[model samples]
Target: MFSHIQKIHFVGIGGIGMSGIAEVLLTLGYKVSGSDAQKTTITRRLRRRGAKVYYGHQRENLKNPHVVVYSSAIAPSNPEIVEARRLDIPLVARAEMLAELMRLKYGIAIAGTHGKTTVTSLIANILTQGGLDPTFVVGGKVKSLRTNARLGKGDFLVAEADESDRSFMHLSPTIAVVTNIDPEHMEHYRDYDELKNIFKEFCLKIPFYGVAVLCVDHPAVAAIAASFPKRFLTYGIHTKADFMAHKIKLYPFKSSFELKINGKSAGQWRINLMGSHHIQNALAAIAVGNELGIPLSSIKKGLSQFKGIGRRLEPLYKNEHQKIYVIDDYGHHPVEIRETLNAIRQTWPQARLIVIFQPHRYTRTKALFSDFTKIFDGTNELFITQIYAAGEPPIHGVSAKKLADNIHSNSFNVHYRENLNDVVHDVRGLVKKNTIVVTFGAGDVNKVGKQLSKMMKEMPLQ
Candidate 1:
């Protein structure tokens, strides 16, 4: 694919996933250029790495590149995309470019509705510790690495395969990991059964020699295991599987578990992430390590050294004397929110839970309205922000105010804040001592938690 291509341009370069891929391509000696609606920390970093980044997509930003790649978030009518089409430059989807990159290396693509970022980072860390020097492209920044993508000397290229648009079908990975499957991306599928078949098709994309590591604990994932006879491996906690965790122990901000492969005790493993969801995420990585024949000791050490992704329940600040704890997570889905809340409760059962949530896309808010209303009972205080329209036209009755009102009507204490420009002001009175302030959303709602943390850090102790 790179036979005559020297430069590549991206349409939505500042996106979390697109930035990672752009970085990898930059490191591989390609002249990279991209344009986004706004300049972000990602764009600045890419600029530092010799990428030509332009703000506000214009036809003029489409420099004469051999090929152009665009983010899924970008609309088809984007000026750069239209310009590329008129200029006769080959235009590619972001996943198509990712697939081309994977074609050049031994790919390990992690796919699922959730946990793909953490799982990809864990596998990369383990492989690195095992002396593979593997390349990785994660959707979120890894705390330890301080970056989301790297081009390594080894042959393996581990990446997070996105399923939001069913773009994950573009790659043929040597080891495919499906953490779990749920009814998500309903915009892409007609029904749940169709989504299941799409995932199964993704698993079947692997060659005869490749393996699909699935989480059978999810009935949808297990339902598709029959698609690949001997080509599938299983990993789970509640059910007996090929790779499983047992005797799990979770502490504040950390967790450990006994590892069992093929029903035989491999060893006890520990990771620097909390919650059963994290434990399940670790199991997926462990299964990958075991499949690669990486020594168990290396796997254990890698997991222990893992500091986790930036927003997968990342703690922004902690002050025991002031009893102020704040965390931010990229959990917009109901299952993710439930698991994160469960993890928080398991770690700090006594702390008063305060959640600030912002709905992401209008489509998702409307599709999962019932589930969203049901998950807020456990929180002592809840602050709901207006929906962030991520380039989507608003659905008629799918405002965040409606969701908040519905939850309030359910006899829960919910406060709706329409403006988040001053998120701290919107909920300052609610931040009492001995409370764990957590932000749940994929949008800028995390700013609330960040602001709260800053306020707590600067405030004098009583």
Candidate 2:
């Protein structure tokens, strides 16, 4: 699709979404260059793959590029972007580039507010195991592949459709999967209805011969499916749909369930993933696999063998000596946090569930404050830090301390730590036998979990 474009430069190349596309273009033998505010592993990996990487944006960074791609996080005022526009270089949004890549293959785009990464990773795993060798791009690093993007020799291309900026509308996938829709990214939409309508439009993008896969368990998703005019299939735990999972058994680190496809029992399935949320994610992958004519045995094996993606209930360290377990998760939304805590409780019924949470964005925290207060029911103890503003200006009257105070008023064990260092120290002193310390949020909260784990490892045996 980008045959005439010889050189491509990305504005925010370190971002997970942007880096993936950069890697794919590099693999395709395109001259790739990009700039980010900071250096990260993703950027380093891209540089190693023969792409020129810059630590920060500059007008000079846009030199001799046929097209410039900028991520949603980048602003129009960025120096590189300004230079590109001034020079009349073709500037494209990251989603536009991703859509162009999809245009060259049978695209399978996974869209939703949550579970998109997991479902995309699961589908990629299933396709790889089935000998499809589909090219895939996911938001998070897949533990099995150790990377977020790969270029394969197959005709299928699997990708995660980002809805935060409503850029997912740019993608017209041959096979589309909507895991679930929730009230998120309110900054971009007027209300929940508008968000739901956008999801409907995304589903309608599928061609006449293609199909849309949706989760019927979510009431919002189910309601949208009713009005969908094109071919679609539903999967869920509570609803009787085209694909379903039943008799689910949740364990500490794994779950198993019976799978059914179109009212017929496919077989039993198991995954090394925890929680009902993850089970639903696997069910969506099952739907895609079934539609692609992959054998049930291969699907089962792929799901069962799947290790997991980074920052999704990933266990960082387990100290048998101190009986402390450290886990990190990238769940900033109230529903995601609630489900993650529920999973932790179901897995370790006897352990004290201590949560160290860093609220992601001030706007999100302000928008979902009420929901956050009630979602920590399973949390035995809560420690919150200052908000991690993902490039947005701090919204007045919205602070993590305020959230901690409100949650504390609800009679739950809540504490407010000013920073990650304080959290690490507090956790070091509070951790006792059978304590499950889970760092929660989409920001740098995982760093606290890693530090706590390192501290636990250095403690004297006792």
Q: Per-candidate RMSD vs. true structure?
A: 1.4, 1.4
> How many collisions per candidate?
0, 0
lDDT per residue (tens digit) for residues 179-289 in model 2:
888899899999999999999899899999999999999988898788889999999999889888889989867998888888898778889999989999999998899
Point to the candidate with the largest lDDT: 2
Clashing pairs in 1: none
Q: Could you give me the TM-score of model 2 versus the true structure?
A: 0.97
For candidate 2, which ten residues in a row score worst on lDDT?
404-413
The lDDT per prediction is: 0.88, 0.90
Where is model 2 more than 4 Å wrong at Cα?
Answer: 320-323, 409-411
Question: Each model's TM-score, in the order given?
Answer: 0.97, 0.97
Error of model 1, residue 402, in angstroms:
0.4
lDDT (0-100) at residue 107 of candidate 2?
96
